[model samples]
Target: MANFIDKLKPALAGSREGPPTSAASRGPSPFWVMVRKEFGDHIRSWRFVILLAIVVLACAGSLYASVSALKDGQSASAASGEGSSSFLFLKMFTETDGSLPGFLTFLSFLAPLIGIALGFDSVNTERNKGTLSRLLSQPLYRDDFLNAKFVAGLLLIAVVIFSLGFLVMGMGLFTIGYPPTPEEFWRVVVMLLITVVYVGLWLNLSLLFSVRFRQAATSALCGIALWIFFLVFYGMIVSLVGNATSPADTAAASVVIRHQDWMMLLSRLSPAYLFQEAASTLMLPDTRTLNPFITQDQAYLAINAPLSFGQSLLLVWPQVVAIVAETTVSFAAAYVAFMRQEIRSRS
Candidate 1:
């Protein structure tokens, strides 16, 4: 009887193993596997750790300044009956005690650093180390490898940005003793998403450089140089163009508005400008338009009435679309370049 049971066990085991597993039942796809590996690498990398530390410290300092300012403003707000506390939650992002800039200011300056650091060496470094050829030598397709790298970096950016944004919101809730309205909460979520998109623009740009340049340092420098150009020099160039194209001093209001409109269009070419406009409008409901030149009609409009969340979103929709378009174009360029590169193994 024991021998019969044993012989049956073998048959049962063979039957269980008889059916071949389909691809879907096999483990995760190669693309996802590579994504996980790259995401883990970014989290553990020293550069990422250093950048995150700097960002966290900056957030802490700005939050402290903002909270102190808000507390001081409370008395005036209560006495005036202006109900400043209504949007108190959003103010934490745009308000500061003058010693340090607000949260948005810090984020605008530092977020790009995070993106650039994560992706500046993504492709070239692997190639230089002779790992690129070996990685492609496996079951991984070129698209999977490239897409995984970008997707992993994007996931990391989302994690970092969303975490910090919510951390600030949580701290504000505790410190201010005021829960955000649903509208304010949604606005904050949108702003954080915009921030992620803005950072992704830089990430994709760096990825493009990594694919184009053989040396990681060259790619990194190119990324930083472009950042510096937009942050510092681009505004000056815009100003010069605006001035050169300035209308006569006695020009009609319509003419002046057109000139200003053209300047606004030119400035929007810079992603930094687009980001600032979007962040400010989203966080501050009082903003009515992106135009710097206020027409007489707008000047006569009431100042105390803040736009609803939907309205604010509509106002910034173009800026948001423009940033997304730029990011997509950059990633597409990188994809094409990387796919065309020849992979060679080296000792």
Candidate 2:
């Protein structure tokens, strides 16, 4: 009996020292482990590759068009007395080819798709493959999974946005033969950051749908539907509502002003609208105010010179706040939904 007890004691001691029993004792935090896993998976996936290639090609084409237009504009300005020859580096982002939209416009249009693509299947795919249960059974907390996914998606977005912004600037420098001014560089950086935030909002929205729906297709379709509604139909609806609420006769300035303000408020409810307003204001320094009802004095102040970077940011600060608030609300909702979700896989 003494020998038997001695043998068992060795076994017990070996088990105690063999492996970690708690998550913290692991080599790294589960959150970071999961983040690295998700980021790698995203970068390697065919979906990411295809989408990134599309964006790069589109940007390259848009930059080509913009540079050509800038050259023409510069030559015309040299020939004419009306055009000003300042901030040519900044013009590369804001200037349009005959009918083509600028680089910023292209970004605003496609950035949401990238975010949605990254998040639409984040959870549902794991569940569909019967991995969610196994994954959660590891030494990890539930929130870690969700938080890691959100952070991974955000990091992906930041990389892509900043890379493209830098690429555009580099191409512009080679072709336009001028570097961006300090103010222009900072403005571009701010625009890129805002774009990341804008796309992050869509990422959270899609992630929420991913958590709520068991099917990936359903979540993807829901996200696309929301995007279409905001991007296409929301503006039309706002216009109709404003016309319906407006006075029939254009006699009262106050009434007209009220109607315009109501329309602006309603339009801002859409993330797409908020992003466009903010991106446009950031890219184009000449834009002084988002408010259409600026007083004569304000208009007079803005006519002779472009607003400083600080003033431009100030003008769009409300839009920035609204976008950030919407992003936070979406992420919070996703976090709650994921936390309350059942981990059981459907047979």
Candidate 3:
């Protein structure tokens, strides 16, 4: 009986080890596995931890300032029927401290850094370490590698942005003793989504630089240069060009109007400007439009009547479309560059 049991055990072990599974047929889905690995890497890295801390501290400071300012304003206006505590959540974002900018302003300024930091070294670091070739040798395709990096970075951005936004809202509720209206809540959600798109454009831009440049330092410098060009220098350049091209003081009204339109077009070319216009309009219900060409009749009609959520969305639809287009173009450029790149490892 013991000998027969031993024979059956050998047979069972042999059956269990019939054939080795192919790479494609074994393990988890490549895309998801890659995504999980990259996402975990991002969250565990010191870069992400430092950036997250900085952003959170900035947000906390800004929120504290805003709440204090709102409290003072409310106390001063207690006698009057004005300064109702409506849209407290929006106010937390838009209200300033007289000493510091509001929460939205901080987000607009610091958000680009998060995207750029995550992406600037994404590919180059692997290449520098001679891991790119080995990584590609796995069961995963090059598409999976690139897609995982992008999707992981995007998911991280969404988590950070949404978390901060909700934190602000929670703090505002406690400080102001009021919750957001349904419309205001939806507006905040839309603004957050728009912000994710805006940061994603920067992420793709950085990723493109990473793929194009072999050295991580070169990619980082190029990414920062592009950001500075658009954020700091683009507006000045546009203003100079507009001034040079504008009609003389004696020119016809139509000619000056055309010059103004051209200036607006150039300004909108800056992603920062587009983001500000869209976010401001979304958070501030009283804001009707960012256009400079509002006629007297139109201005009068908009007076004292806050735009509804749908109306505000319609006004900013073009800006939203432009952001999406810019992001797509950036990602496409990175994809093409990475696909065509050679993957060689040191001997």
In candidate 1, stretches whose alpha carbon ends up further than 4 angstroms from where it belongs are 1-25, 79-83, 301-303
Candidate with the greatest lDDT versus the true structure: 1
Candidate 2, residues 1-347, lDDT tens digits: the string is 85998889889988887556576565778899999999999999999999999899878888988998988888888888766866778889878776677898789888999999999999988988989899999988999999999999999999999999999999899988888889999999999999999999999999999998988999999999999899999999998888778886856888788878888999999999999999889888888778879878777766677889999999889999999999999999999998888888652
How far is 81's C-alpha from truth in model 3 (Å)? 3.7
Rank order (by lDDT, best first): 1, 2, 3
In candidate 2, which residue pairs clash? none
| Candidate 3 per-residue lDDT over residues 28-94, each given as its tens digit | 7889898898999999999999999999999999999899888887787786857676676788898
Clashes of 3: 0
Off by over 4 Å in 3: 1-16, 22-26
Residue 226 in model 2: lDDT: 94
TM-scores for all candidates? 0.90, 0.92, 0.92
**Ten-residue stretch with the least lDDT total in model 1:** 16-25
Write down the lDDT of every candidate, Cα atoms only. 0.92, 0.90, 0.89
Between candidates 2 and 3, the one scoring higher on lDDT is 2
Candidate 2's displacement at residue 153, Å, is 0.5
Task: Point out the higher-scoring one by lDDT: 1 or 2.
Answer: 1
